[model samples]
Target: MRASVTITGSLEDAFNEWTEGTARRLTDVTEQAASTMRDELRAAMSTAGLGKLGRALGHAGYPGGGNYSIHPAAEVFVRGRAASAAKWEGVIDAFNDGATIRSKRGWLAIPTKNCPKGSRGRFLTPDQVAERFGPLRSIAAGKSVLLFADVIAGKSGGVRKATAGRIAQGRESKLTLMFVLVKDATIRKRLDLDAVIRQWETRFPAMIADVLKDG
Candidate 1:
């Protein structure tokens, strides 16, 4: 359930060694485990005469992260298990009665027909996001480029304000370029997201390396 790693070396040397060795090994192991689980799910699906359903089941299975969703078929299968049948039946009943599933990552809320219109299905490729926002170029310069951004719906307004205040009060370096994305109620607010990203691209033209997206 838990793993701990320890390295005996100078701090810098230990960090560098760990980054190259254990960190890379952990990443590889995690990926392999996920792939194996996918294969197992695929095999299970094939045996059930539901290859498409199997593929979907594989996609829904969480391999590394502590989050997963039971596909409709998987839910049925779990409910059919002789030992856990009653418990699973209760779960199925709750799900049918509109109960939200909870996972380690976050609460799972089922959207209803009356749910407010929002950017649910929209996505931006890394390149498109970068092109719109420009490269976060300044992040590479000076003693350190202190990066700050508002996580969507993050409850840390005071933290953000204090961070900005610290920079203003000369407690933090002026070389730090701040990036703030305001989430607005409407789709039009995302137009602002594009502009804020572009400003970063324009301001720190020299430091642009790569842009990443939350998968």
Candidate 2:
């Protein structure tokens, strides 16, 4: 779940010989790469069926004397959703990892009465589900999920604060899915860290070379 690449060689010596501005330039490059990585990771999760969690994904950076570190993570509110979040993660992993899910009770069904007339008899995409329930203005996912009847009866007041808080904070219910998606082969290839680091490796030398030339 974690990866890092260290660049070593005469490069360090060259950086040491250069001005402080050169070190700052290297840090800028690292921060930019980290930003891109975080964005791509969020995008990949959205496409991999974890879009709901993308809102909570964020990144930060720390600069030291000659290096910087980027941290991309879900915030405290997202971490608070461990229980139901785990259940959803299991469902996604079971499907992605090729583990079959069988239920004697039959597919967990949702009523289609809320769907648009044309969408009534078919499976609805997430967008369609959102549209069908748009009047509710929010979804619940902790101990209880927002149900059709709850929306109908306007009984979501109790969780309305929690729902609104999540929305305002841009946190999502199923965040573990983002972590799992990062490890997935297809997603990993698309966000390949090694390739990103290689590009940085090539650029680092050129950056120092440019600084030295200016000096």
Candidate 3:
């Protein structure tokens, strides 16, 4: 985001002072661009109004593990607060939407009831379904899972002898929950999965190094 500060002094004086100070402070920093822009904006702010302000611009990278860039700009006399608020809101919305997919090593496994005793077919509760499938609970959280009952389907193919016992007892058979083993963490992230796997490679570099060393 960019912001400008007004200066009663000449534009050249303001620009020179601001640029030198900013360059000295942020030449090699990770946020060099943003820092420089902020300094320039502060210089402009020292001036009374937007009329004496020069241009200031900044680029803030994504706060989350996603790839996003925030560019903000404002002239003098304009309140920077509104623009800053809007930029922050945009970032929050992006995070809420789960724009980036993260990866993990293992999968979330859930077990469901294929059939209950005394029922001709198998049946599974929504909770059981969620336990087997990772996304069911996430999608169902803060709302009624019963509302999604229509979408749940069931099928039968292989049955264990013990499971068959329950089926013969009149358990209802139905598609309880869809089981999906996702190898990529990105899929869950897209589904708005709560957990964010960040810095996994860094955290597990020893294991990765071993694999690489062997390979």
How do all models score by TM-score? 0.24, 0.32, 0.18
Ranking by lDDT: 2, 3, 1
Which window of 10 residues has the lowest lDDT sum in candidate 3? 187-196
| Residues 1-215 of candidate 1: C-alpha lDDT, one tens digit per residue | 99999867689986676555543444443344445445554554455454543333222222235422211111113323465665644443443233434445332222222122225643433233334333433233342232322212215421222245555555432222333222211111101123333543453332211111111
Candidate 3 residue lDDT tens string, 1-215: 99998768698987676655443333223244334444544444344243222233334422323322222222222224788756544433343354533236454332234322224444544444444432342234232122121121234654322245456776554433333333332211121212222332243344334433543
Task: Give the top-scoring candidate (TM-score).
Answer: 2
* Tens-digit lDDT string for candidate 2 (106-138): 323343444332435465543454454442232
Candidate 3 deviant stretches above 4 angstroms: 1-98, 106-165, 185-215
Collision pairs in model 2: none
Error of 1 at 71 (Å): 27
Q: Using TM-score as the measure, what is the rank order of every candidate, best first?
A: 2, 1, 3
Most lDDT-accurate candidate: 2
* C-alpha lDDT (0 to 100) for residue 34 of candidate 3: 39
Candidate 1 off by > 4 Å = 1-11, 58-215
